[model samples]
Target chain A: MATPTPTRQRRRGHDPESVLATAVGVFNERGYDGTSMEDLARALGVTKSAIYYHVPGKEQLLSRALDRALDGLFEMVADERASSGAAIERLEWVVRQSVRLLIDRLPYVTLLLRVRGNSGTELAALERRREFDRFISRLVTEAATEGSIRADVDPGLVTRLLFGSVNSITEWYQPARGASADDLADALLKMTFGGLRVDPAA
Target chain B: MATPTPTRQRRRGHDPESVLATAVGVFNERGYDGTSMEDLARALGVTKSAIYYHVPGKEQLLSRALDRALDGLFEMVADERASSGAAIERLEWVVRQSVRLLIDRLPYVTLLLRVRGNSGTELAALERRREFDRFISRLVTEAATEGSIRADVDPGLVTRLLFGSVNSITEWYQPARGASADDLADALLKMTFGGLRVDPAA
Candidate 1:
């Protein structure tokens, strides 16, 4: 028997990575609640039965996709840079790493940010997300306590605004045309950490 | 006929304002694309036909809801404060007003921010949103040109990060328990304009 052609091989290649990537794209575009197995099947160019050859089901796919984002964050939280530095410096490192992670895993992180806890999968993802928020909140509080951060603003509020600017990158960032992740992180850090206004004396 | 009672009047009451507000709530919850006419009707405790009696259709409601947010932004843009001051101060005023508007008309602005341009209504709203963004971009550029803003960072990037933080308020703000608009603006301005770090000499 003759070997399969390249076209046939490419058509049949519904690997786990490709499937997850396609599913994430469809989820981001239509929203997880709006997307169905049929939509995923159509996007994957595979029959519904063939899709079962992938991971178990939509929720499982969602779990994996959310983990792609959550795992990156958890890994960052465990990094030595995040743990060993002065509180303000550690907070800066974490924020920079988060910007890089969000850009590196843009689709997964975007999907994670939009989760509204409508299902078991979404609820679990949200709980994990809240845990991450609490970690950042502590860093902010520690920085405030150390007197590196200004004392006037609430630590909780600081966490929200600082990361809010970071997360908003997902809304408008187009990887092909946008600044590199480092450049984006630098501008964000400078604006939030150093004032945007010009210093007259300097 | 006997006069209608207050409870009966309330039950039957589906005014234009109430209908738009309810539709926006359902849209935000289920997403504009995910929500059906039936969902909006169910949310309002009315039949689908009753919804049509109040408004022409869902798109009309969306257009009105978007206008509610956009009108507030454009009004701020046209104000003397937004136009007459040093560009940096003008930009500051705009940001503060935007935070207040987002809080005041939280649902409508939330809906506006989530628009992805799927339909003609969404497309129109997006165009208006872009126009507002252009107004802001110009303000940032003007501030940079006037040397009131730091020259090293790109004005376009600054505008995005600054407003991105402001717009992110809708994702987590809970009016009943959260900080008042003035306080929220103060924190945001203090962080972005004055910087979050403690000054060494001061």
Candidate 2:
């Protein structure tokens, strides 16, 4: 073997991304504050200094994880805004896309859901989440204005419930089971938008 | 005015319960780990020893708070099960009872939701929660089997979504506001079982 390539026994260039992903997994399992850098490196099969070279510290890893989740979320909002559809159509579109975002970036979404607005970083993530909520509330208002949805309830509450429905998916969804993103969207839509109660008396 | 007796400052017999309630309020605000006995005393205008006399430690306070929430939940299940006309009736009864339970036991439920299953006591609370879930899941399965509800999806998922709809009330509910627990349950019931979409023929 030429030069005795370090790839055989060492994680060389893969250290950074691999370490970050490992950090996310650990953070999700033990929570951000509950986990330490030592635990992360041990999980990553690397020395603590090896993790340091990639990220400044655990906070940076959390920030990176949140950045990824928020990017996906904001991208979904941007795409839905541009998508030409009725308001209810747009709301459903957002729901589907949000579900996809959660599934595609499951660990990040899990971390996002667990944040309690304790840290500065977490508070920022929560604020970004509020902005996302405001976006959904506007869509719900539009849907009600279009007479596409029930006008009786507050739009904000509806938006929270909608978001809660999607966020709750991460609690039970198994990534290892290989369920597709669209499959989750299908189940959610069936239960949420489409009423579970069939219509003879509906 | 004549000098008040020393017992007057502490109230005759309600002091411990009042102190525990005050402790729960602050615990809900600051989280279990973040809160201190000093904070509890400051909230109650009592000395640190007073708090220690009432409860053994912070963990005991947490356990007491969670016990209140858990007791409410378990009672809801029992009450709903015994005082029902039909299976669907029982399900709706449980939902409304749950929303009321969350509101009546706001601080306790909030603390219960935030526990991370980190400590032994926390783990016990988590186990009790799972037992509650299994009990509700049994109701959901029985309802489906009796043909009072949709039998297409798993009963476990239905139970999760049912609580998902109720547990989320704490995120936005304000007891001081004009919005009452009944109002929340009404809106939530419509948003959940009825959904936001209009009838196709309407």
Candidate 3:
């Protein structure tokens, strides 16, 4: 109590991570542009000063939320399952993991997906998003070259279509109301790989 | 000049539709909150008053752009091809037409896809989007019931997945840089119906 507990050591009720989680939901609902420190404080049931103790301002909160989503995504691509399997197998693994990740981090991912590059943080996030897309695009290109999927669709187009479908999950998926993550992942994989892999029997 | 032609009939270069088209691009680029009437006028090489002459304000520009996208989508469902054929066939037709429409009306559709519902116009557009999604969800349900597509996936989820992939076309499909609309539609249909239709062979 003498030195004033560091932000990390703050009580369980108001940790930075928990605050960011709550912040993500508010950001997604009201939009980064429409939300303010006062709004965030009101949602968190804390004063603006309390929020300030952990982060600088709304932009930093936005940056942290984007980082949370991008980190999960980039981590999936780096996972051995995503990196080591046959190109198609690896792609399937990434796709499955991506759905699971989207469900697990729904709020953060939702905020990241909706960013319009209005701020420095958002522009950086967009660049990282493009980097992530390029990484997957390479996987699709490799899968096509290996003849693991249809050769006719341009790999870039395939990447867009596949993730477009994946990212759209944010719009409708509610973990509390809908299909289980496993069920969602299983169905998505079937539809994705069914359309992707050249043959169903294979 | 004698009749003081209405803005719609003022000139080919300054028609409402063309001005709206330009506005869509600006909205997509600047995050609707970040854009202003002055920004729009600058983009169109017109005075702010000129833009106001065609559209009442920034909100109207956003509303009109959303209407353009929503109208095309509603028209598809009302079409004989979307409303009448076997569930799968109708869905395939809609999918094909959606791709073609997204390409043809790329800017309007892009702007519509990015709205975050922060204002009256956005909230209204969001409701219409939900209506459009509900329409598609019904199609997927009918298709599943007819055994024309996989029944394991929830039709609601299927609608999201199908459109997620389809709507994603806006992220990357540049008519100037990529595949022809026919080519994009062909690949998407093959992937979409290939995964959706119950029988891969049929």
Candidate 4:
């Protein structure tokens, strides 16, 4: 099919980026399962036929939205910073980057965290999420093995709690008024890494 | 209304405690909004009429279930341990107790965490939850002022990340196979309060 006329595109007012952003906002507000194609159309201010021209169905949109979050994570996983240096340093870098990614893609990440494997797309997303968890878990284990982190607490538990704190940012973070991603990551790392208590020796 | 016959009660196999427990389980699994009275009835293995004999409606059950979690938190707030100690010690005690409370009433707390204020009952619960967060924030501030916890990080952010770790326990904690409440609390305290890094001087 030929591209739409420039005037038609201007009248529609939604590009792919805006469409996904609006769809994610609706999904987060009403929940993915509760939202409908008509809801998406209403949110986009476009007719249902126009939405179909952009995407095939709701599931396709869900897949793309989930990928927006998952892809950021996998990109972090592949980064040299995550793989190099001492295990503890690498772990710290990954956690900081994770915070940046979560903040950068707040809506998508929020949607990703709320997925419950309700459909094939959701299940796939959950699988990728688990894979990300496994990567973090390995970093924690390596940090423990290298004798940088304390040994008494289980590494698995550490991974969960550390990332749990990271994930919780999505629940309360307001970008307009909240701390920048660097400040959030610094606060989190300081609390979890250097410890929250004042050093007696200092 | 008069009580049902013992034989009938035995056949129905649900007391108030059991009914609430079962309802919370269903709520956690399917979410409060997604769950219906018919679903609760089916899960309880009783007729819809039989369910009404025990409780008035879903909202009533939700109120009770939310109370189960909130009451535990309020009880902790009322305890002498939370009030009489150094702010840092009291904060530690509160965090430990919160882990125990979340574990002890896993389903109830899980349900509480997922609430989004869609109804009067949920709105009331959300208000109570914010009150709890404020209580924690004050303790963190006190601890920082006392120079116990580090002062550089914002106390409010500290409270959020600290409890964010604690609350995340409900996401993966398995009562049958997971660590006991004491063990969980110990690990959490050691990480957030004592710090996760090994002492280089040691």
Per-residue alpha-carbon lDDT of candidate 3 for residues A59-91, written as tens digits (9 for 90 to 100): 988888899899999888778888786888888
lDDT of 3 at A159: 79
Off by over 4 Å in 4: A1-7, A10-12, B1-7, B10-12
Tens digits of per-residue lDDT, candidate 3, B85-154, equal 7887888888889988999999889888887778989999999989988888898888777776777777
DockQ list for all candidates? 0.81, 0.43, 0.36, 0.76
TM-score of chain A in every predicted structure:
0.94, 0.90, 0.88, 0.93
Q: Scored by CA lDDT, what does every candidate get?
A: 0.90, 0.78, 0.80, 0.90
Clashes (N, CA, C under 3 Å) per candidate = 0, 0, 1, 0
Tens-digit lDDT track for model 2 on A1-202?
4675674457564556777788899998776877887888788776877766555788888988998999998888888353568998888888888988888889998898878887899999999998988888999999899898999999987877667777777766888884577766766666667655545463
- After TM-score superposition, what is the CA distance of residue A169 in candidate 4 from its true location, in Å? 0.5
TM-score for every candidate vs. truth?
A: 0.95, 0.85, 0.82, 0.94
Candidates' RMSD to native: 2.1, 3.4, 4.6, 2.7
* Model 1 DockQ class: high
Best by TM-score: 1
B1-202 in candidate 1: lDDT tens per residue? Answer: 9999974675568777888898999998878877888898788876667666666688888999999999999999989999997999999999999999999999999999999898999999999998999999899899989988787788788888999999999999999999999999999999998888887677
Give residue A200's error in model 2 in angstroms.
3.9
Indicate the TM-score of model 4: 0.94
Error of 4 at B142 (Å): 1.2
